[model samples]
Target chain A: MQQRDNENRLSQEYTNSVLLNGTLQTPKWWPYLVSILGFFVVIGFVLFGIQIKYGLGVTGLNRPIYWGLYITTFVFWVGISHAGIMISAILRLTQAEWRRPVTRAAEILTIFSLATALVFPLIHAGRTWRIVYWLIPYDASRGIWPNIRSPLFMDPIAISTYLTGSTLFLFVALLPDLAVLRDRTTGFRKGFYTILALGWRGNPRQWKMQVVGGILLSALMLPIFVSVHSIVSWDFAVTTAVEGWHSTIFAPYFVIGAVHSGVSAVVTMMALMRWGWGWNEFIRPEHFDALARLLTVVATAWLGFTFLELLFALYGLDAPEIALREMQIFQYPWNMLFLTFLLTGYILPVPMWIFKRIRTNIALMFWSSILVNIGMWLERFLIIVPGLARRTPFVFTWEAYSPSWFEWYILFWSFCWVTLLMLIFSRVFPLVPLFEQKESEVFSDDIKIGRATVPTIFREEEE
Target chain B: MVAEKNRSWGMVIDTDKCNGCSGCVTACQVENNIPLNDQNKFERGRVMSWIRIERYWEGEFPNVKARFIPIMCQHCENAPCEPVCPVYATYHNNEGLNVQVYNRCVGTRYCANGCPYIVRMFNYWEPTWPEEIRNHLNPDVTIRSRGIMEKCSMCMQRIKRGERNAGDQLQDGEIKTACQEACTTGAITFGDLNDPESEVSILAKSDRKYSLMPQLNTNPNVVYLATVDPYKDKNLGEKAKTNEH
Candidate 1:
C-alpha cells in the first residue's frame, strides 16, 4: 500500500508539471500546420529569385505611376507592424489589465511585419546592387552625401532606427520566458533555450533588471514607430505635385491609418492563436471585447481624418485637387475599391463592433481584419498614383497600370513568408508568455479585493 | 571681363507664338538622346519628358478657355532643391545652370521632391535600348540606369559645343538649344542673360513676360510672354452688339 501511494504521487506530479509548463504537451496538429505554411514560404523564395533576375519591369509600374503594388505592400506591412508596440508599450504605459496574455502575440506581429516590409524598397530599386550608395555618407570620394533636405534620405534612417529598436525590445522581453522554457525542456530545445535565456536563473535581482530593461526599450520604441510612418507620409506631402500630395494633415492621417490596420491585424492574429493553441480559457471573450473597443476607436479616428481631408480639398478648390477628388470618386476604374475601403474597412467595422455577437465571433473578426488590410492598401494606392497622374497645367494623361505575373507572385510570396515566420516562431517560443500569465493570476484584482474586503490579507497564507 | 560677358544663360519663351505643336518637346528628346516614351508606361501615366506643356482651364463649360503653359526646371536663383540634398549631386553652376550630375546621384529622390516644379524623374527600372537603337545613342552624354535621378540640363552639351565653336571663330550668339532651333515661329530664344543685347535678355525684359509661381520667389531663369488673343477686342465688341440686337 505504501509503494502504490508513492507511484500515484509521482504520476500526479508529472501531469501537473506538463500542464503548468505548456511545453511537454503541445497540440498534435501544430507541426502539421507549420509544415503546410512552410510549403508556401518556399514558393515565395522562388518568386523572389525571379524578381532579382528580371528587374522592376517584372511589376506593373510605369511612368506617371512609377509606384505600384510594392510600395502599397511596404506601407501596409509597416502599418500592421505597429500593433506590437501599441499592444506592449502603449497598454503597459496605460496600465491595462488585459495586456498580459496579448503582448507576446503583438510583439511577434511587429517582428514579422518589419521583416516583410524591408523587401519592398529593394524590389522597387532599378539597380538593387547600387542600393548601398543610399547608405554611404557623402564624402570627397562620392562627391556628395545624401541631401539633408530630402525625405528620401530620411526614409532609410527612420526605418532602420525603428527596426533596431523594436527588435531589441522584442528580444529583451522574451528572456524570462526563455528561462522558463530552458528549465522545462531537454536535448536540442534545451540548448536553444539555454543560449537565448542568457543563463537567467530567475534570481530576484535578475527579474528586476529584466523588467527595467524591457520597459526602457519599449519606451524608446513607442515614439520611434510613430515617427517612422510620419516620415513616410512626408515623402508624398513634401512634393509640390497634385493637390492631395501636398497636404499638411498627412502625418497624423497616416498614423491613424496605421493604427486602424494594425489593431485589425492584431485581432486576426489573436483569433488564429486562440484557435490553434486551444487558449480559450486565457484569451476569452473579455479580451476580444477589449480589442473590439480599441478597433472602434481607431475606426472613428480614421473616419474623422477621411472627412477632414475631403473637406480641405473641397474648400481649397485647387484645380489639381479638384481633379484628383473627381478621379477618386467617380472617374477612376478603382473607385469602387476605394469606396469599399471606406465603407467596409471603416464604416462597417464600426457598427459591427457595437454588436456583442459580431465582435466576439472569431470568423467575423478574421474577415473584418482581412478587409481592413485590403482597405489600407487601397488607401496607399489612392494617395500615390492619382495625385501624380493628374498634375495641373497639362493635358490629363491617364496611365493604366497592371502588375505583371512576377509582381503577383512576389506579393503572394510575401504573405506566405510572414505567415510561415509567425508559425515557426509560435512553435519555438511560448505563444502565450507563461511567466506573465502566471504572475497576473497570482496578483489579480480578485485576490487583492478579497483581502481588502475581509481585512485579512495574510489569512490565506497562514492557512 | 569674360565672366561679365556670359555669366548666366537663360531662356525666354513667347507664349503668343506657341501653337501647342510639341515640336520643342520631340526636338529636345532627339538631341538629348532621351528614352522612348513606352506606351505601357504612358497608360500607367508615367511619361518621362524633360520638358512638358501644362494646360489650365480658366472657366467651366462653354465659357472655358484653355491656357497652355510650357514648364521645366525654372533653374531658380534661390533654388529650393539645392539646399535639401544630403548629397550634393545637384547644384548651381557658375553660368546659372541647375546642373544634375547623373554619375554622382544615389537616387535618394529628395532633390526631386524638393523641387517645386516636379521636373526631376527617377529611373525606377533599368533602361532598355535595343541593339540597333544603341547606335543612335550620343557618346557625349552618359546613359542613366536605374536608381538615379535626372532632369533638364538646358541642353548643356549643345551649349558647350556651340561655345567652343564660337571661341574658335571669335563670335557671339552663335549657339542655341534644340528647342530654339526647331521653333518655326521663333517663339523660344536661348542665350546668355548677362549679355544685355542678347535676344533672350531683350525678350525677357518685355512688358508681357512673366514667370510662373512668381510669388514663390524662385527667380526662374526661364521667362514667358503671356499669350495675346488678337480677336479679344473684336469678340468683346461683337458680344456687346449681339446683346443690343
Candidate 2:
C-alpha cells in the first residue's frame, strides 16, 4: 500500500515538474538569440528618441501625403492586437477545449500590442501634450470640450475602454492559474504569484464568480473590439476629401483586415512557441490545422472585401475615385507592393491552408503567417497614402512620400519590444493553465469508462 | 438683435473674369496666417491651404480646355459639416456665416469629411514660421497646431474687423471678405445677400450665376457667374446677346 501511494505521489511530482519547470528548461541558445534581437531594439529606441526631439519633420511625410509610416504602423499594430482578445474571448465563450493552453499567450499579446499601438498616435500628434484635450469631459478654462463630431475624440474613448475591458478580462481568467502557481512555486516566484492570485482558493464559489465575470467581460469586449476598428476606419471614411475613403465599406473592411492580421499573428506566435519551448506535445498538429482552416476563411473574406471595394469604385467611376484607384494600381511606385499584398495576403495563403500537406507543414505555415502580416500592413498603406496622394482636380499636386530610415528603425525596434516583452512573460508565467489541463484530463474517457465498469471495488493497482 | 436683422454675408465670383493667377489663393493664405508649403510637407500631401484653386481638364491632351475654380468654404445654407461635429465646434452664425471656432476643434476631422466641397484642411503638423516671417504673421488670426482642423472661414477675422470698422463709421453693409476686396478685375463681389439692392444680391439673381455641384443641394452662398467662351459665340450675329438673363 505504501509503495502504491509512493508511485501515485511520484506521478503527481512528474506532472508538476512539467508544468513548473518548462521555462527553466529553455535551451541556452534561446537567450543568445533574444539578446541579439535586443540590440536592434535598443537601436530603434535611439532613433525614435531622435524623431521625438526633431519632430515629425524627420519623416518623409509631405503636403498631399500628410499621414505616412507612423499612422500606418499605428493601424497595423492595432490590427495585430485584435488577435489576443479574439482568440481568448471567442474560445472562452465557445468553450473550446484546446484554448486552455493557448489563450493566455494570446491575451498577453492583445494587452501589450494595444499598449504599444496607443503610443504611435500620440507620437503622430503635433503637440503631444495637448492630447489631454481629447479626453472626455475635461473642463478647461477655454470652455471647450472635445468635438463630439470628430472620430478623433471618439478614438481615445473606444481604445481606452477596450484596453480596460480586455486587461480586466485577462486578469480575471488568470486568477485560477495564478493560485496554482502560488501553491506550486517557492521563493520570490511564490510570493509574487500569491499576491497576483488574490488569495484564490479552489473554492467552488470563487471559481463560479471568476467564470461568470470573465464571461460578462468577454461578451462586452467582442463588440468593443469590433467598434474600436470601426471608429478607426471612420477616421478616413467619415472624411469627404478622398473619394475611395468616403465609402461605407470602410468599417467592415477595417474590421476584417484587423482579424486577418490578428489571426496570422496568433498563428505565427503559436508556431514560435511550439518550436521555442518544445511544446510539440501540448500544441498538437490538430491545433495548427484548425487555425489554418480559420485563416483560409479570413483570407477569403479579406479577398472578397478587396474586390468589393474595387467593384464599387468602378461602378461609381467618380473622377477622384478613378484617379485614386489608378494611383494605387498603376501610377504609384508601390503598385508592385500592393499587387504582392493581394497575391500573398489573400491568394497564396488560401491554397496553402486548403491543401492538407501545406497545412501540416510547420515551415510553410510559418512563412504564410509572416507573409499575411506583411501583406496586411501593405494593405493598410495602400488604403491610406494613395488616396490621400491622389486628391481631386490638380493631378500635378500628386506627390509621393518615402519613409525615412528613422521611421523604419522605430518600426523595427517596436517589433523587438513586443518580442522582448513576450519572452519575459513566457519565463515568468505558466504559459499553460495547469488546473484547467488537470480538470480536462480528469474528465477523459478512460477514467470515466473505468469508473463506470467498477462498482465500490478498491483497485489499488489500477492507479 | 438689431445687428442680426441687417447682416447677411455672401460672395459672387465671376468665372469669366478670373485669370486663375492664384493671387486670391496666396492673398487668403497671407491674410489668414496660413503656413508656407514646405517641400517635404508638400510631398507628403500634407500642405495646408485655406483657399485652393482647382484646375479641371475637360478635354483630351491636344484639345484640352482647363476650367479653373477657386474653392473655399461654400458656407452652405444646409452646411453638411455642422451637424456631424460631436463637439459643436462648427456652427452657422446668424449672418449666414459658417463659423469655425478654432479653440473648440479637437481635430477628429469628421466635419472635414462630411463637407462635400472638401474645403476643410487639417493641420497635420505644427504651423512653422521662420524667424523673420514671424513679423509678417497676421496677429488677428490664430496659428493652428497639429491635430486640429482649419479651413477658409471666408476670412472671418477680416469680416469681423470690417464689420467693426463699418460699425464705427455706421456704414450700411460696408464689410467685405478679403477675397472680395483683393480681386483686381472686380470679379468677386461681397455684400448682404438679403438686401435685394446689394451688389451680391443682384449678381446672384443673374441667369449666368450658378453654384458648383448644384444637384448636391447644399444651397451654397457663393455664386459663380459662368464663363462664356467668346470664340464659340463668334458665329452668332453681331448683335448676339452675351448676357443670358
**For model 1, what is the error of residue B158's alpha carbon versus the real structure, in angstroms, after optimal superposition?**
2.7
lDDT of 1 by residue, A1-463 (tens): 1311331222323322432433556578867766876787787676666655655555676545566677778888878888888888888777676787888888888878887887677766555566566655545456556665666667778877877887788788788878877887899989999999999988999989988988888787778767978988887787654467788888889888988888888888878877776666567676788898898888898889988988877887776678788887777575886788787677767788898898888888878877888788788878776765554443444456677787777778778788878877766777677666666554553234644732111112544
Instruction: For model 2, give the interface RMSD.
Output: 4.1
- Write down the TM-score of every candidate: 0.85, 0.85
Q: What lDDT would candidate 1 get against the real structure?
A: 0.73
iRMS for model 1? 3.6
Model 2 agreement with the true structure over A101-178: per-residue lDDT tens digits = 677777888878887888777766544555566665575755766567667667778878888988898788778878
Tell me, by DockQ, which candidate is best. Answer: 1
Name model 2 segments beyond 4 Å from true: A1-16, A19-54, A140-142, A184-189, A316-323, A330-334, A445-463, B1-8, B35-49, B55-67, B76-94, B104-134, B145-149, B168-173, B214-219, B233-245
Tens-place lDDT per residue, model 1, B190-211, is: 8878778888889888878888
Task: State candidate 1's DockQ.
Answer: 0.38
